[model samples]
Target: MFARIFADRFVLLLLATILLASFIPVRGHAAEVASLISSAAIFLLFFLNGVRLPRHEVVSGVRNWQLQGAIFLFVFGVMSAAGLAMSHILDNILPPILALGLLFTGILPSTVQSAAAYCALARGNVAASVVAAALVNLVGVVLSPLLFALLAHVGEATVSGQAVGRIAIILLLPFALGQMAQRWCKPWVDAHKDLATWMDRISIAIAVYVAFSGAVVAGIWSIVRGDELAWLALAV
Candidate 1:
């Protein structure tokens, strides 16, 4: 059972990335470079997705009201509620930012590339997944902060232009550009399906590495106690 579970090459690579982040966490200017590289990988990831999926499929997926409605409620209502509950329960044990991070994560939408890649791998509707991911994230841009303000009561909620711009550049813009270039690019992507799959995994791993490297550099291990870390992991 253990061997079967560990058979996934992606999981092994993910573990390796986490281990690398723990030991050799990037810092200062180097960390910024890593972040930029990860962002580029993500941009490429979504762009490839846009190229591969058909426009007609995207349109039809968006019009699937029942499925989209269910996802909307689950992501916004259910996930947000769960995050809030976890935040309250773990409040005593965790640092404020860490506890709040749970809610922040919950309120956020699924990543376009990662979600669509998983759906495709599972032989599911990649078009629907892509549309769903994009739709929810677009809603999340407004809803996430509103939920935080309402539940956390953290004064007036403010979103920075830089944050929104980053999301647009990394997530939305590349996908849009790819859609425009899809006429020419789609054929190539279709031919190199395996390479595209690897791109998905590589981008995801780089993202994980950059994320954990930032945490490690910030002294998360030193600040968060062992028991607290365990509980945090469990809560997550």
Candidate 2:
């Protein structure tokens, strides 16, 4: 059982990526190139998502307002409150930035690809999961910054027209184009759904690598001690 669990490709790949990032993170010009590649991969990932996701499913999913509302409230309200409480409780134990990072994570949206993947695995409503995840992110773009400003008393310089434009270009534009092309490409996409799944996994792995590389570049490992990491792991 342990071997079976450990042999899972996704689990192994994730650990490998983390280890790789820790040992040899991309830096300088290479980091910039990696970031661009990661962005393109993400764009392609969402584009394929648009092509594959059935319009009828999205329509039905959107109609389920109650479910969407519940997800939003849980993510933004309950989870954020819980994170704030935990930060306070661990204020003395955790670094101030780490505690703030925890709070920031709580206020974030539900991840689209992972949520939909889990829903599919559980034989749940994948369409609803996709819709809920998208809605959470759309709302989060506005709410997260405001929440940070109020709760953390941070200047909230991150949210701006440029940020919104980047979101539109990287995420919305490709998805929209894919949707427009879906009628012609749907058959091919459906026949090769496994390919799309692999692409999604690759994109996610790339994102993880980029994130960890950034943290490494910022000296996160050096600043965070072993015991502190243990506490963070337990808290997570």
Top candidate on lDDT is: 1
lDDT (tens digit, per residue) of candidate 2 on 1-236? 88987977877888999999999999899999998998898788778777887888868989998999899899999999977887777778999988888888778875665676556545688667867887787777888889877888777536667766777787768777877889998899999988777776787788789889999999988899998998888776
Instruction: Rate residue 231 of model 1 by lDDT.
Output: 86
Q: List candidate 1 stretches off by more than 4 Å.
A: 1-5, 95-97
Provide the clash count, candidate 1: 0
Error of model 2, residue 41, in angstroms = 1.2
Q: What's the true lDDT of residue 29 in model 2? A: 93
lDDT of each: 0.86, 0.81
Query: In model 2, which regions exceed 4 Å deviation?
Result: 1-7, 117-123, 155-158
lDDT of 1 by residue, 1-236 (tens): 78976898878999999999999998899989998898889888889988987898888998999999999999999999999999988888888888988888788778776787778767799888988888887777778888888888787877666766777788778888888999899999999998778888998889889889998988888998999889899999
Which stretch of 10 consecutive residues in model 2 shows the poorest summed lDDT?
A: 113-122
- Model 2 RMSD to the real structure? 2.3
- Clashing residue pairs, candidate 1? none
